[model samples]
Target: MSYREERRADQVAERAQDREDMRLKLEAQLEAKKIAAEEKRKDSEAKAEQTRRDAEAKRRQEQADKRARQQEKERNKAARRAKYGKVTGWLNRNPVTAFVGFVMVCSIVPAVISQVGALADAGVFVLLAALLSAMLEGTAWALTFMGKKAEDEGRPAGKYRVATWVTAFLAAAVNYWHWSEALPNQTWVAVVFAASSLIAIYLWDMKTHGSHGKTTEERREEKARKQHLADRRKHHKDIAAEADRLLSALPFGSIDEEEAFATAWRIKMGAEPGLSAEVYANATNARVALGAAFELGEHVRPELVRAGMLATLYNPLPNRLSEGIPTLGPTLPIPALQRSSGAATALAGIGMYGSEAASGNARENASEKDGGSTGGNASGNSPRGRSDEELEALLPKALKVAAELVAEGNQISAAALAKRVGIRRDDARRLRDRVIAERKLKLVDGDDTELAG
Candidate 1:
């Protein structure tokens, strides 16, 4: 009985053990499946992340490539511009050669295109025409250049200029004739083209070389010449102003005759008297008028001043007497002195005399009394009277008297000078003024006599 019971129990126990082993195997298989699915998901995520990184890198490389291409394009453009600039600069310097080359290219290329079948003949003809045009233009340019050069050198450019104009007209006519023959139906178009070409060449020439072909050296010289002229004009103006000032400063009163004579000499020698002949004449007239006024005991008149100036300029001495001084015996009457003086003749010439008939009668009477011609006493003096020779001859003596007056003292008046030199008061005043002006002396403000150099 014990063996049978033990066998049954053992069978049951074996069945239970088999059931538990199957459950554990199924659970392990399920757990392995879950882990495999998680690993597949992680691998997919990693691959996706790698693909995004690759795409981003590719996008960045493409942008860099685009920027590099743009930079390269800019560099190429700049290089081309620099090369073209150099070529243009060379062409500008050699305008004739450049124009010839341009003409040849334009003519030959067009002929080649239009006469493709007869290239050899058409090319030769086109080249010939271009050469002719270029030569004509060159001739004009040469003539202009030569003329400008001559003008700059101060030589006559008339011949060269005439040749240039003639040559230009002939060239233009020839071009028009050639265009008319080449494009008979489109003659107007050809004329316009030829004219435009000519104008272009002229404008180009003007741009490269000035119209006058003025070189840098010539321009500088012209500037210098203008400056020199301006300086000379200023100098002349200053001299004129100084002369006017001196004339205006003269006192309108009686001056000693000796002083007046001395002053005239000083003015002629040292006071730049002839800088203005008009001013000198005016001063002489004032002196003579002042003397006359003093002698007559009257104020100086405008008409008398003008008459005296004319007399001094035209006739400095009396016609009857060869010398300026009268013999010191008795004072001559005013009418007698006037009739004998050449000053009356000058006054007549200036239309200042009171009556033409009176002057004529006086001259006739003098001529009869002197037993000489109407003008002079068998001297070389003209009918108008004696020249300034007599006055000029007394210059030395007057100069000596002036030196003595200056040596005497700066505090001297016209009256004192007249008494000392034994001359008229008006003449003395004139002489004192002449000496002061010639020496560039400064006059004392209150004292009319005192002067300092």
Candidate 2:
């Protein structure tokens, strides 16, 4: 029994020793794995911290750079402001000039704003402004046409009466269109406004200035001066409109040399004021360099009649002059010019040429005459030259009579006064009769002959 028990006990002790060794190996392996995982986590956390710091530093640097740039811009702006102030101060020293400039700026800004609106239908306010300007301009043109006889004759042109009425009508129309979106309502308002304005202006100019019996000569002179000033405004308006039409036809980058020339030719063919020529030459340097190649021309006419510039167009014999080169000559046949991108280039050649361009002018004058004018057939054989002084003297009288006739309307009694005024006696009597009928003038019936106002 002792021998068997001893063997069993020894086996149990061996088994316990093997288990202890296995446990120690497992514990060592677990400790190594835990250390590796902790090292990896620390490395990842450190990398993240580094990234965050770099990002923060970069953002600070960006903010600093932005602040520096803003400072530089502000400094430049301050310098500009200082310079501008100096210039303004100098101009202000002269009150008259400063006032003129201010007035000009005020008028120009409004006109420019209106023009911008007209270019495209935009906000209601902008559209209204544009319509107002258009109406004023149109009215000026109409009045110009009506007052043509007086204006050309060099007398008082006419009052602002017509222009004001037209402006009122246009203003009303604009208010009705974009603001109210009602054409009929706007039109009716315009009609009423125009009528009222016309009546008021007529009263101011024709009636207000009139004396109970006879207006003072000084007052008449003042009225005439005002009328002439109004005419000057009308001329400027017409010129501006013509310039605008040309501008509309030639958009930037839209027209090549050929297209630009074609536009010029179309306008020239109409034979209206070639005011567009001056403006187009100033728009772009390229257009200026390509000058008369873009001008209007009909079938080649006699060179002698070209804008009275035929003599200048002719070539000079190089030997005849100091230069050996054959110079530009009048006898040279001016070829029908076609537009090109860079054929004969220079702004001097196209955009702006003073007396220098005379050499190239094929026909600047349009027509030439040795002795007579175009009215030879209709005016008979004798030709007369106008003496401006004579016209000046006669124009005033004619203007006065015409104005009276206009004011008299249908009721004027045309009689003896008509003859004195160099018009039909009947016309005068009609005018006199009209004044009395309208109660505009006082009239007393002298049982035998009626005395009239």
Candidate 3:
């Protein structure tokens, strides 16, 4: 009973195993089919994306080409406009010249031919009369052309211009006679004929003379340029000749006219253009004189005073007292000093003490007696304290003198004030400070404490 039951159980287990294997095989086949379908879908999506990208790139390239074509068209249009603008500008500027030329060619040729042909009808040789008319008008036009050419070249064109007018007048007279003879009752026709011949020539002449609708500013500039050129030629004839020589020596187009003139002026004048040795000397002298006037009181200021230069004034005596200008002697009294102070100072000590030394010494002795010692005062007062008191006494007078110097544009220093008012340098410095504080004046360069004595 156990063997039979075991064998049946084993067969049942085998059948169940076969069914499980079949189920797994079916699941694997379904999974493979799903994977293939997913791969095909991904490939289709990739192809679609590629097509879209290609379409976008092609559209962008076409748009870029369109923009390039449009830019090129606009550039071509602008270039055409510029080309037309230049031509129109030239035509606008020369309207009168163009009009006159057109009128002369259309009217003058026919009128002159007919007028001379009238002479042929009066038994003159036809060919000879035509040739004579052609010669008259041709000669006038030729002279006009030559005159304009000469004027443009900056040459003398007056004679050619006059010849052109004379020839035109002769032609007018011939036409006048012909018209007057042909239309005896209509004498105005003779005048009209005469005017027709002269009008074109006159307008052409005016155009060449720069009166063809030029503005007032243009005319003024032209006149000024002519005057300047004339003045240069008149003042610098030698340089002008040298310039001409140099211009002729060099290649025709190598050097500009003004450049040649400048070179020639440097070579011939031995100085800068528009300047001479005498003029330079005069200017230098004038400048030195002005500087010297500014330095009149500066000699007393050792720091501000320049070395190796002295200022002097040439004061003349009154006309009532002297016959001519009075010269300064070595020991003569200075008028500038006399005006500012009542005393006469020697020129030798004018920069230093004037007449203040004796007063300075007496005050020093008095300060020594009152200060009670030979040494400097203990209150930071140099020398004696009484000297400061004496300086305070003289401060009013020193201030008056300082004010006068300031009015004359002189930069006041302690030394200059001390010399003027017979005071010590320290007292003078105190007086200067009082003046500055009271008057609100700026501190000048020469009054440095570093340079104070």
Q: Root-mean-square deviation of each candidate, in angstroms?
A: 23.6, 37.6, 16.7
Best by lDDT: 3
> In candidate 3, how many Å is residue 269 off?
20
Query: Which pairs of residues clash in candidate 3, taking residues 3 or more apart in a chain or in different chains?
Result: none
Question: 1 or 2, which is superior by lDDT?
Answer: 1
Number of the top-ranking candidate, with TM-score as the measure = 3
Return the candidate ranking by lDDT, descending: 3, 1, 2
Estimated TM-score for each candidate: 0.27, 0.20, 0.38
RMSD of 3: 16.7
How displaced is residue 161 in candidate 2, in Å? 54
CA deviation > 4 Å runs, candidate 2: 1-11, 93-453
Error of 1 at 299 (Å): 48
lDDT by candidate, in order shown? 0.49, 0.42, 0.62
Q: Please give, for residues 244-309, the per-residue lDDT of candidate 2 as tens digits.
A: 466577676665533443455455544233334544334333322332333322223323224323
On residues 98-181, what C-alpha lDDT tens digit does candidate 3 reach at each position? Answer: 887888777687667766866687788988888888888889889999988887798998999889989989888887888889
After TM-score superposition, the amount by which residue 396's alpha carbon in candidate 1 deviates from its true location, in angstroms, is 58
Query: What's the lDDT for candidate 1?
Result: 0.49
Task: Quote the positional error of residue 302 for candidate 1 in Å.
Answer: 55
